[model samples]
Target: MIKIEQIFNKKDLELFSTEEKNILVNVILEKADVSKRERKLDIFLLSEDVLTEQILRKINQIISYYLPQTMSVSIHCDKLEGENKGQRLVTKAWKGLLQCLFTEIPACRIWMLNSRWELKKDCLNIYLEPSGIEFLKGHKICSIIENYFIKLGYPLKVVFQEKTEAETYDVYEEEREIIESILKENEFRNTETNINALSPNIIGRIISGNPVPIGNSIKGTGEIILSGEIFDVKKRELKNKTTMLTFGLTDYTGSVAVKIFLSGEKKSLEYRFKEGLWLKIRGKIEKNRYTQEYEVIPFDVNINEKLERMDTNPEKRVELHLHTRYSSLDALCSPTEVLKIAKKWGHKTVAFTDHGVLQAFPEIYKASKKIGIKPIYGLEAYIFDDESPVMILPPDKPIKDVTFVVVDIETTGLCFDDDEIIEIGAVKILNYEIVDRFSGFIKPKRPIPTNIINLTGITNETVKSAPPIERVLPAFMEFLDDGVFVAHNAEFDAGFIRREASRLGISFDNKILDTLALSRIVFFKLKNHRLNTLAKELNIKMGSHHRAVDDANTDAHILQELLSRINEVGISNLSQINDIYQLRKGVNNLNSYHATILVKNSTG
Candidate 1:
């Protein structure tokens, strides 16, 4: 597997410390998948992550350095467009043929593992490197490779030659000014990856090197080393009275079981192969003829430590939320391992907010107490807070006559304390009708961040000539007169208004309704309660999401849709908004989501 980051050593991965290269290697191999039958080394990933093209080619070059010239390689991205280009080159008939040659003939294993084949009407051309040509000299592998296919009713002369290098690799040489040259021509990249850091001597010589991800072990390949935690070990007495340990190994990507017969001194080490112990095993992924499933046949087992990510940030961010195994069906991370790492990173506090289960609390307390960190106990509780009055300053006259002003505000940032409201958009919904609309942009105290500008398309240039906050705030307050305040997340929009008013010494209080809160009970089965999600659910035509006018209009439709179904949840008047959810029944009805409440002080 090519670690493009290491070969090219891009700035993207330069943050990893000198000592953390092992962790980087582990992370890289985690994404690699190899399928020999398909002749593909698919590093298919679509994340905001970077691996330099040159580094990738060099890393790949390193992987094939020891392999035969028969393995011509090139890198191609199969993203947004999809991986429709065919990868399968050799047919099923070519399986046992390659495996037999690999195990018996050293020359074939070194040169022919990834042999390129060009099947023509007249003959089959097999490209090997010049060295591979010499390795095959005086060896009968070419005749064996070709004759095996001929016996399968395919007659064609097998021609072997040096493979043509892809044009992509040649382009890599042109970019050597900024990027360090990773590999010289016909040379290997550094083979000192962290995968084999703690390789203890096993068998005779050290059985360690690159460990292929279990997901991409290039099925039926020999010398496949899988490094990860081992578990589910079962010891049974063999017919010869020797002990055999059958256990499963998982690198988090995939899992495979290994059945190893221990002899003499090795029998005493049965307990060492149990759960929670991470081990790197060198072996072969062999398929069982009867069961038709692949399993590992171990040759050497070495003690290995799973790489724990370390936070290099001087001011580390607080891990306010985490889920343990008790979270149910979603996480395998236990409280001990999580807190151990958090404590190691010098985090003062850690919180366990598992999904609705306090079963993890007892364990969380013990772990945090032992680790000398404050533990905030909480869960992603269901939405059923009767104590939280739904409508703030309820008008007490919202049975049907009260108008609802569905308002949305785009701000400079999240917190209303310091962040300013840049724009305000509102729609008046009188008895399910969009009777009026209001939209305004206000100049902020500071320039908008580049990312926010990109996200909302709200630039300083657009708002520079617009009215300042002093003028826009008063107009918005007048437009929002007496109507029940409504927004997707009413608190966020309403809070900004309150803050702006308070700053100017204006008394601002209104009847507030959260369409977000309403959607939870009204459309309880909805996967999420986002504004766009609700609008889409109701088939509403929405404008640009971040724009004030369009989002307010869309949120207005969402509010009306929720209002139509409010009776289903027994919520009618603004006063009865609190009754939308009744404790026990409400919790039992809705699905759980991931959230957390961290108590940092004595007030909690």
Candidate 2:
């Protein structure tokens, strides 16, 4: 008798609240289909079986607020005989009321008949049907019912009557009782506080926010362990007296030289050297030049000692030189790939010597250390003299050509000893490359003029904390390994070295070579013979033209190029090149007498 189609219309939809309107729209959208001609629904009126007084109150409130016309809404409890005419009329009236409420409130409605009440003699049997569920899916209608109950401050469980058993329904009285009990138990109640009940360890952990106490100690040999990348491992002879393991070590503390006396079995030390593992040095703390900040010179190093993994600090060890892919005119590799190439070449030591800036050093050092290779610190510096830049080589040997020291000096002016060396950078080179390099700001025995710092980029802040020349010279000498000292301009660096060495009461008698002279001889046709020009001509990369390490490295590369050319021309001995250079220096112009003397010497 109560028809859902008659009540469901746009005019009826205007009666619902905003939230109910949204729910109605969603329900209708879900059920409506363009393909369908008509949709059917049923309406039902049913009493809540398990609903308590609290739930009924909430339901009444929702009905009053959203379905205002349906005030005094009630659940009727009545038994009806099969197909009784009066009972049918009552049911129809109830169904009509449900249809009106569902349609007017702009909501989908479903009813559940309490099937669990069927066994009770006092329970009323009922039929339940959806009033407007054709507008929404069953699950969606159930969600709406749950949301509505929540909004109304009721916590009753609502479920959809199955499609097959649309006429049968049941609800449990015990379910409502259990829900009420749970809500009651969950109401706020604070526990009694007892500060003394906590364990001391628990209290400590809570206070410190750490699982273990800071005071906890681990038992071991009390020996302090240090792990670092081996910057350089060279057999150095110092003062023409002591042969020592003059190696540079870079760790978390900082980079410094570790001078180990080579009295032990050479084979034993050699095995550890070949292992090429990052070393864990356990030795008594001894201050050494190579030891940048902290010194631990072990008399015996266990090469087998496990290398601890450490993160490379970007601030400490930056790539002073590197070449990008864009450097096609000279360099053939990217900054990252250059490190890979160096690693492949079995070069435990490498410096990025890229033209200008320490930009690439960070990435290069990070990548190199990952592959178990320690990079030697250096930069290939270019020197500009009289508007012409020059490359300086590591000094020659007796004074071995392969083993020479790379030195960088920041001077007040070009006159060497007259212009004090304000800063010094030195690295040892063997086999035509940098093995290790040292860099430090030096306090000029005299005030650093503004012009000097501006030109050299060495600020007062940099040299402010630098050790005095007296302190720096001795450490520098030890780091040099009495090897040939080299720089971009040999005369400039040699003058500073000789002056500084004298100041320290030590004599520096190492042989010297100018890479500028070497470059001029090898690439004579180049228009300009400056360091930058020669580096570009020879396809050599450089970095920070004025910085000592960078300039030193540029000098190193120029030396490499010259050595390559010498080897090409079948000149195996460096002594022959030195003799030729010396002879050329002796004669301003080669007359017949000089030519005959030179031929006689060549034949001899």
Candidate 3:
């Protein structure tokens, strides 16, 4: 499927023509059951013609009828041109159709797979949970999905996987009242250590030690909170008289099989394991004794609560960069919850800027009006746009096209002239909130100095097997792509990267912003502008001071805070801010190295 971001951009319209747009509009009108006054329509079409640059204009034109002015229309098209197009479209359509069905169908449980649609000529592969399989077998669910595709001119050859023992079911409508009554009778005991009380890095640092990047296998206990949809659960009676249950949790990061062992009689708790439920769990992490594979043994879990409706107030200022729980492990707010909190804080306009993916858009859009807030939809995308370095959205518009990637690097020494980067970390921010992260460990030719190792906790042994800087530069630069380069002390980090890129025969020229410079201008009352100091002043969490990812994350938050302050002072446009900063250069002439000297004195 085309990325939602690509489809939303007005530039995508250039692909379609006037005639094609007219054809698409006429065809859609003839087929769709839409109200005359309906301002928004998201149409996903499978076209018979191969969509080339020549024909893309029509689709663009058709989509243009609903613009940011009147109503928002997002159209995604899959051309029925390739030999596998029919199968691919069928699979894609079913995945979405099944997700929609789960919302409407009662007593139905489905474990939506993260697997991409697998298409081979005429065959398409899909899988359903046991309840979903049974529901389909009895209710002609296949026919409903098939008919929807048929209307769009495609006959599907679906290869649904056979139901497995672990395929779970949901609480029946009859069972809900009973379970609710039982839960009401025995209220939850509040734990002293709630999620909010824990440090932001506790899961990654104290509990499990930085979350093993999803997909990499490891052994031993890893205490962490994983957020994902509960897809399946399998109950087994072990020879030792303990009941072992394994559940599948999936997120954009990946999937994991979490197993919990129950001793004594606790079968009543089984009802809590509902399919399609979104949960964040905290508990013991241990490796499977036999298999040596890792699994989380969750002791406590929190199911997300529904957001309450609130009245609107038009005078509230907009929060352009805010993240929801969907931003992997980095954020603690869900789309609805973020809006609810924003509403409680008296904000009328907020942006839903989840990293890379736009999965949060649908939920945020639905919750916006109910919560009395207007959501500006945008993404913190990672793209390489070197040729065109400057792209800013108009100040009066809802959003700017420009993106910023806040970066930080840890090196063997201070001076870029002689120092080598040991690690580089950055996060992409769109509309001001962190969306995606890039982390790479570089193996420098020189051994890391003892003082540097003591500071960064990166020993010479750490990067022994890691890729060299030259090998990592290409991908790192690619991830940097076409965004505005931002750093707390922009000159230090960006300058190092530029120096390295020059050595590697790569051109590295993207506009750079120094939060240090911006902070001195915005918060002139402060005696100093260090990342940790600014973070403390703004009340944003700083995980690890010297680490690349943590510093980058903090820098992103500081940038968000600065933007909020800047907007309040009547500076809204990125271009305008850049121009002002150009005039304000040397006002403080601060560098991170200077701040580090102060930090050393304090520590000493």
Candidate 4:
């Protein structure tokens, strides 16, 4: 019979030899006992350094492959002789042997076997190892044993040897004295509570280390607070007597929209929320990326318990880059009309530079701010004579001989003499469609004001970091070589480009067409000519109103509208129409006049 006994003194622990240590390690490994008590045997043997490098390496290999994190290993030894030495050797050998068993066998089953050893009198007598139970307790290894036993339809019990009466009496006396002294202390009474009378509510309030029951209950509606803007609300009818309210709300936490299906009691929330108002909401929170936050929604919202008003200032400051009917032949709305709509859509500020003409800028600028939207002024113009418009806007590969370029320039202030071009934006159109675009903000050889930065979202920081205009202009001219210049107000953009090119010792001579004139001849209903109003009237989605790409795109769209109008008016050839239009506009010079008339008559 193995008598299990605790090794309390160092002298008794010294009895193990390298061989015995190895045998013990092998025993624990074979037993598959991972309990803290079983593991202590490994710790004890490891402390003695009885393991060989080959064995240690094998153990480490197993651990690394099976464990989540690396574990520390140690080996300890004092001598190398006797059954104790043989036992150590056996234990170390057991470590390797146990690995083979555990390679296929589970650690839990080993724990179950170890736990059952306490119940077996012969096994318990032979092993008399208190360290086994202590190690198990430290590692909470008995829980794994309990789980295995439960799965096997068997109950597990941990049995300890009964203590003598004298021993129990001594322990009771010691505990009693300690308890009495603790009760006599003032601080102890405040911190310690009687466990019997503890209720859930009292348990929650108590801060002392007393065990308490945790109960579950349905959460009440009074706990949640909801606030957001009502972006949309729609009422829909259900079967016979039911109705539904679909609403959307956006807040800092992000947007949430819901469809509430209702009958009688559910309709009680009807008075709580209204269209375009803020309201406090109560409902089960859900997670649905497709919808609000939840896919499978659970609770119906109890809304209208609270409502708050928010400021409704329609005009908000935004970047100014928009186009109107005045810039496109098919555009139907004016700059003033676009501003009015922008005001309705809650724009705080607006810009009114028509395609090429600043003509509507004065009126729209005056009217926009009066209606609470700030107004900006700028034009979408054209670049010509530097490169073929085909380079910018290429036609469909199957078609040939139709090309145009639209351009816009931002300069320092409005004075023709003092202000110089600070930025250039252009797009090429071929077969009446935009094909390519160029946008660059140039650093003028002068300082820019804070007002310009605030208005244009451009600053010294940007220009200081950009390449010099002298470097950019040549590249731009090279890109624009031989393209027909198309602009809302052709003269302004063409005049600026011509002036800038001549300053750089380059000639600027290109055929030009004004989208403004084309719009006047095609769609005459505009009260005022501006790009944004015309774009909106034409149902174009105008984004980034003042940016070059946006304005160039709008100009390209205008060209498309013009060609469609020309087709509608029975004009068959674009080259011929463009020549006649140029002659009638009186902007054509002697060379351009003869060339255009020759092209027009020859095409006819």
Candidate 5:
């Protein structure tokens, strides 16, 4: 008989391989505690039914690896079995409620609420982790959960435990303050900044153009789109009598004045261009040589057409670097809005790389999971390095932190056994700023699949001229050499890179950092730690969510910030970061070459 003792902490689980992590996730309480009195391991499980033959086998395997000399293992399972039918019904209802909540909110945000429950008399007590208590008070989230359960016939009370020292000391506070200051100085307020997004339908600006402002000089010609009511019509009594028509126009942005000149036979337009009659004029703007002011000269004029100003939505572009409301004051949109726009545009995956935080992940993951959209989690981090100028390292000099490379890969599918890497995106960071970037799409041995094409917005025509993975991998390897490898899910990217490098007879064992895991440690209060959620919470903006360079760059920013906090916790080296991240050392099980196979079979 195998006995299980003690639960595995979150930190303990970090050291396990991906396969081991998956197995541990299924086990109750995970990790058996060693009992000195019994001289055996004791495992605490949530339910007796969880101890299946497969789980037992894995458990034995783990025990053998850790405690080879042990004879008998003790398994302790505590469950609420043999309950009355009413109690069972209530339990089922409670479970259903929890699932609904998880769907609505990220599990990370409400991890505390997901804790085990106890029934005493008529009151059902729901216990939460200490990290959840603060959000509970400010948001009344507990009452929301309690009222929800109560409506379903179970009266409940919520309880919070004492916080640990780790939970109390937020190492990212200083970094966040710095980021907040940077955002205030840098991020553009969404105002009348749409010149780049101006409609293509508008008449070329050069005709109705004004002198362009360059430094203090009025240089070249520019155009204007003006709409308003005609205020006055005058025949300028000059050497050559000129017809002048002046009108006022107003849009949501502001108001503008327009002028139109009609000559000879066109002077008949003055009759119809009466006062209070609204019209739109498309024209060139020129500086009045006398008054030294800019005014429009009409190229085209329309009668009674209401030219309502439109906010341009430039060709359904995906912003891999984006910030939502979660990035504190740094961002403005919500996760729902971001997801809704993404889905509407048929984007398969969207990423969230927040400023050194993962509080936004839960909402993005939960929202996207059911909708068949993948949410890529990333971070804009800050890193700290030794200030010494010399490159030579003595024992006391400490290993100088040099470069961090954030990487993202897009593949044909998930199974690495057969899947081919189609694209690679990476960003190089030095001193907390992105100094360089790398991106390329590889032509796989097989044709690109329809689903992948849809998922990544990369079509067959896209990779036709590109080189294969073998040719591209070498360049990428050279670019990534000796730098700390960072990715949202470092295991997936690192696994793929490691296996691909192995195939090429190249060796790579760069220190790795998983933003996914780091977020869990730093933003423990967050219920969900997905990239988008973190972006929203931390006010980090995303440029293009899933695309390689954008995701990598965003994650690079996150890395810099995280390194700042990591250093604060006395972790100054890549090895220490790797220790916390527990970098996975196995190949990812992604589906291989589906598109290539399909195309070949069809052709044959």
Candidate 6:
């Protein structure tokens, strides 16, 4: 079935989609044999069971796209199966990962090209040059890379390993030495008295004026004094036999490029103009003609190494609200690293209120629990509640006397004719307390979709050992009792149950109460009424979101909270609860706020 020629023919393939690149990343170069004119490679990849046939085809296509034309290439793809597949993907993808890194972060260049990486057990051990390690540690870059791959749909770790002597290389040696020997043959007299004499004291006298911060220096800021550390230095030889040394300078406020033409200097700026060295310069900001960008030209340079410091206040401060990578452009830090830093900084508790979604909670839970910090789950939700309330209640009964059955269900799929119910969970509440519970899994006719299996962790094997929906539904219907049919979204759960009952020619009718409707009116100030959002706001323990029992149990808890709020406002019965649904008119209801809600204890 595989087309061998198109794959083997040398086709220039510089373009690839994100998904295609990820295919390249999750492969290991098991073997590579290269001759003068040809190259052969053996790559290990996920088995066809783990990846679909379409995905496997795409992976082969990506292999063809990435291999160079210089060699007559042959690649043998070998499939890996079982538990070790994860480790294989992690270990093999490091080379392709650099490409992903560059695409995600523009500043992540080819500095890590020759670095060594391997996945041992769970951690991705990376061996980088010393400077590369410093840069990674400074920016907290490891977790970001890990999280990037996570969003690409796999879980892996990134940990920096000490570079052994064999693994180490001078990443900047070429840039520093290319124009170095030419500096010894100075056309002018030997200009150096002592390069070491150009210290802070002498440099202070040379300018004697406050240095303009590099970030604030604009083009045409003529002959101003500036101070910063050199970060990047590169040397380029021109056709005219002149040498150019360009280095990036930063003062923490901003950064700028400083250019120097090495025509007659006696000493190499490689000694002073190199990366990580601090310098004070008298330079004029001018636009470069070739690159068409503003840069600096130095008049005089001196060593000015400023002492580094950090504020180590040991006071424990509580971080109530923060955002993670889920908060759009607001935050990019991975929750794992951010929570770890919070614990390191003596914060015992923290909360993440990502914008309008509870999708980040799972990551927060896993990360914080690992680091011994309390995670107060919350969100900045979008609220738009202006719907009329639906109330079907016993006319004169007080709230305490009536029993409420809060029900939740998990299904094979959404359609009534096609999909069938797989699981049912229900909780009975009376006198504001959960009095009883019912839970069961029902086998469906069709196979469960892969996504549903992931979301609920329920498999065909799990239901195969259980009863069918025809048998399970009757018991669930009987468990509903004469109580009011209650659910988070009553239209879905109760309606689906009713639809199934109609097939059996059985009458299914109960006074239905929608907790979703109650939440909208009761918590009108909330951004939106998601189950997790309502749970976070009301401080209820939502056990597991997509599961039947957890959601139904949580719905019962929300009902109690809504009932309490209703009673405080003088609503005595279910009919009066609907009166609260009328919009709070004449007020500026259009405006909404990003609120900070927190969990008080472990249950939350």
Compare the candidates by TM-score and give the number of the best one.
Answer: 1
Model 1 alpha-carbon drift over 4 Å, by segment = 1-388, 567-572, 582-604
Winner on lDDT (2 vs 4): 4
Better of 1 and 3 by TM-score: 1
TM per model? 0.42, 0.31, 0.32, 0.31, 0.31, 0.41
lDDT of 1 by residue, 1-604 (tens): 2233444335444545553444334222214466687665645332122445654554556445423332445544422222321112233334556666766785566577535556666466777766787677558777876665554333467778786553112222122321121112101211332223333533223554878788777467455788877777766553444455667888877888776655555455565666888777776566644234577766556777796657989997777777789978968998888888888898877777888788987788787888887777767765544455556656556556778888988888897668888889999988678899999999987877657776788977788898988899888888888788888878788888888899888777777888776677767777787877878888998879888888999988887777777655666676776666662235433444444665556775
lDDT of 6 by residue, 1-604 (tens): 1122223323312344455444544443433555654455444433323444555555456554454332444445666666777665554554456656666664645446536566776677877767678777676679777875574346677888766554323324233432343333232223544434345432112555678766666656467788888887876554444556778888888888886656533224445566888888775677643233577766556677674533277776766678888888888878898787777677777778888778888998888778998888887765544444557544567888888899999997777667788899999999888899999999887777767887988877688789887888888878887888898878888778998899887678888898887776667687778899999997888887899989999988999888888788888786676777553442233335556666565554
lDDT of 6: 0.68
Error in Å for residue 441 of model 5: 0.8
Q: How many Å off is the CA of 205 in candidate 6?
A: 68
Clashing residue pairs for model 1: 68-110, 68-111
State the weakest 10-residue window (summed lDDT) of model 3.
592-601
Flag regions of model 4 displaced more than 4 Å.
Answer: 1-400, 578-604
Error of 1 at 215 (Å): 27
TM-score of model 3 vs. true structure: 0.32
Name the 10 consecutive residues with the lowest summed lDDT in model 1: 178-187
Report the candidate with higher lDDT, 3 versus 5: 3
Model 5 per-residue lDDT tens digits across residues 1-604: 1112233434445555675555444333423588666667776554423455555555556555445555667666544345453355345455445555555555434454324455665555555566666655566656766776555334567544454333322223113333243223222321223323233222212223232222322244565555555654433211233344555444323444455544444445456656665555555556543223455555545554444333256554555676767776788777766777677676755667666567887888787776666666666654422221111121221224467788999888899799988899999876667788889999987766767876778866688899988999999989988777778988899889999999999989776667776766566566776776777677778677766767776777677777676677776654445343232222121112211011113433
Candidates 4 and 6 compared: the better one by lDDT is 6
Model 4 has an lDDT value of 0.50
Which model is ahead, 3 or 4, in terms of lDDT?
Answer: 3
Task: Summarize candidate 4's per-residue lDDT along 47-116 as a digit string, tens digits.
Answer: 2235555554544443333322324433333334543543443333333433433453444233322221
Q: Who wins the lDDT comparison?
A: 6
Query: Tens digits of per-residue lDDT for model 2 on 110-223?
Result: 333111112113122332344433444433544544444343223234343323332221112223332233223222111122223222210101121111111221122232
For model 3, residues 362-445, the per-residue Cα lDDT tens digits are: 898799978888677766654432222123332333324557888999999988788899899999988866778899899988
